[model samples]
Target chain A: MKFGVIVFPGSNCDHDAYHVISKHVGQPVEFIWHKETDLSGYDAVIVPGGFSYGDYLRCGALAKFSPVMAAVKEFAAQGKFVFGICNGFQILCEAGLLPGALIRNKNLHFICKHVNLKVENSNTPYTSEIAEGEVLSIPIAHAEGNYVCDDETFHQLEENGQIVFRYCDENGEVTDEANPNGARSNIAGICNQDRNVLGMMPHPERACEVLLGSDDGRNIFRSLTKAIAAHG
Target chain B: MKAKVYVTLKPSVLDPQGKAIHHSVELLGFEKIADIRQGKYFEIALDATLSDAEARETAEKIAKDVLANPVIEDYRVEISN
Candidate 1:
């Protein structure tokens, strides 16, 4: 499947995502600039992490109004896959593709570290290869990854099985200490109601190589490939 | 005309920066303060031809739709002569 990685100005991880898709996942991928509004040719879109728009007025706030976001919204509405990581996650939420807003880290600091994430739901396209309740080590870097939404929306996400991943310890135990940013319910990732769109704080692309740290993130890409094949 | 917008986190939402500031203030011996909540302020200059009411309306709309995120924050707009 052909993948498109959206690149907004100040996006540092765009190349990393591109490398993971083309080199690691062995898929054809291209960079789609934020000014370009067309996404019809791509089967899937990956919004990589970075300080888009210099994180002005709040992270991902200004980037939401970029021309490409409108096209990205349309792409996802067609039931195509859209994966957003870190700042990309913030952008998705700002674009209303996903629920909740990412606020300042609870500690008021930019946290950069490898954290364990437990798969809460493995049935979606993004997490299909991951076993339920399995823990994967993923690196997260952000100062505003604290996810928050109203009680009603939070409940809706839970009831819909949209909460795909949660912060957890190495032993797969969810606890306060495991929550790196104090995200609501220790949520590390979630998908939309249709499960076609996913937004997560952890950077899976950063963990795709064993030499860098862990190759646990390759499972997500593998899952996506499998899901796309089945989708056809 | 000039318009000022104040955007603040909703009461139910947590404000980590504000919390840190509150703790610092307490440490500085200002123990009587009840709480602290950080927010953003924006001053916008509108077209000079617009009337005060028109500027106020425009500012209000901008505050609601653009300057503030309704999901986690509230905003108010004030127009000045």
Candidate 2:
């Protein structure tokens, strides 16, 4: 299973994502530049986290227009898996490949720390290995991670079970509404209507190893591997 | 020609930054504070040769396609006459 990690300008997590997938997980992986328009050979693509384009206009605003996004969009349309982590999520949303937008932290301050996210829906291939309601501790570093959407869309998300993850307490209870990021309904991650694409604020790749203090995120990658194999 | 794009969160959408600012304003003892909502402003300069309808179409298309998420936000374009 070959994985292609897309690296945009100011993408600091390209190497980190590559390290976890290729070195740690033993999945063949390669780097795809932001300018690259071809993604035909790879089975999956990952938009790693970082302040792309120096986060000049907005978190992922400028990076959305990169040449690679055009291909990413095309690939996603063909039923391929695309993972967007943190700032990568912002870019996906900005590019209209996903819904909602990442706003500034509710408190208007940069938030960096480990957070517990409860798996809401595991029916998707990305979370198939994760049991529903299971809590996974992952690290989040961002100033704009607040997810916002209209009431109708919010209702639709709930109705369709598209809400994938939410911030929660240590005991696996979702709480602390007045938290740092100010994400709506405590949402930390979500998926598109088809559930093929995933965009989350937390870094699962960072938690795939014990050296990172937890292996809770390994299941996500493993699940992807299983799903791809099954698809074959 | 100069154009301004106004992007705002759709109705019934939560605006945490705006809410926080409203709270701060209230805390500062602003008795007349009613409400607040955050939005984005863009100033675009385009070629003068384009017709008003062309420019408006361009702005609206981008807004609907990219600059704003129609599911959660709405945008309006204002062009200089």
Candidate 3:
């Protein structure tokens, strides 16, 4: 499967994402700039985490209007697979590609550490390799990783099984201890109504290598590759 | 024209930052204060001669897309004509 990782000026994780998709998933990967509008050649698109635009106008505010996001919206509308991690999640929310918004860390400080996330629903392409309620250790680093949504959207997400992951402990026990950053409902990730677009605050790429102390995140990228190949 | 947009978290949402600030206020001896909730304000300068409808549209767009996250925050725009 051909993958494309979008690189905004402040994107600090594009290379990490590309490395994971290419080396770990063993898929063809490309880097697309924030100003570019063409995305016809890729099977999947990823928006990696970073303080885009210095987090000045909110995390992903100014970055959402970048030219590349216009194409991303079109691609996402076509049901192409899209993943947004960390500030990428913020960007998706800013672009209206996702249902919820990422707010300041309830603690108001930059949190940088590993977190355990439970796979709430493993039916999607992103989490297909994992069993329901399985836990994966991944790192989260952000000041505005709090996820919030109105009752209507929140209810719809719950009803449609849109939530994919939530903060938990190694035993799959929900806890605020390993959460690092406080998010509503201990949410670590979620998808759009269509489930084609996913936005999560955790950095899976950071955990894809065993040298990083955990390879649990490799499954997510691998699952995407498998799903695309099977569908193709 | 210049307008100030106040972005505040919804009542149901938890504000850890505001809570911390409240604690600090009490420590600093403002004992009579019942509560403290924090908010952000942005003073936007629009170059155009904006009509009421246009101004409202801009503010709404910003509130929905930027200045505030509609998921957790309710925003108000005060315009200076």
Q: What are the clash counts of all predictions, listed in order?
A: 0, 0, 0
Candidate 1 reaches a DockQ of 0.87
What C-alpha lDDT do the candidate models reach, one value each? 0.93, 0.86, 0.87
| lDDT at residue A178 of model 3 (Cα atoms) | 60
The pairs that clash in candidate 1 are none
Docking class of 3: medium
Q: DockQ scores for all the models shown?
A: 0.87, 0.49, 0.60
Highest DockQ among the candidates is held by which one?
A: 1
lDDT per residue as tens, model 1, A41-103: 799999989999999988898899999999999999999999999999999999899999999
lDDT of 2 by residue, A1-232 (tens): 7899999989998898898888766889999999999999888889999999999857898898899999999989988889999999999988888888888786777887888999999898889999999989888999999898877778988998889989998777878752458888899998988887889999988888887788888988888878777766
How do the candidates rank by DockQ, highest first?
A: 1, 3, 2
Best by TM-score: 1
What's the lDDT for residue B65 in model 1? 67
Query: Candidate 3: how many backbone clashes?
Result: 0
Better of 1 and 2 by TM-score: 1
Interface C-alpha RMSD, model 1? 0.6
Q: Give the TM-score of candidate 2.
A: 0.88
Candidate 1 chain A lowest-lDDT run of ten: A223-232
lDDT of 3 by residue, A144-185 (tens): 898888788888888888999999988999887866666767
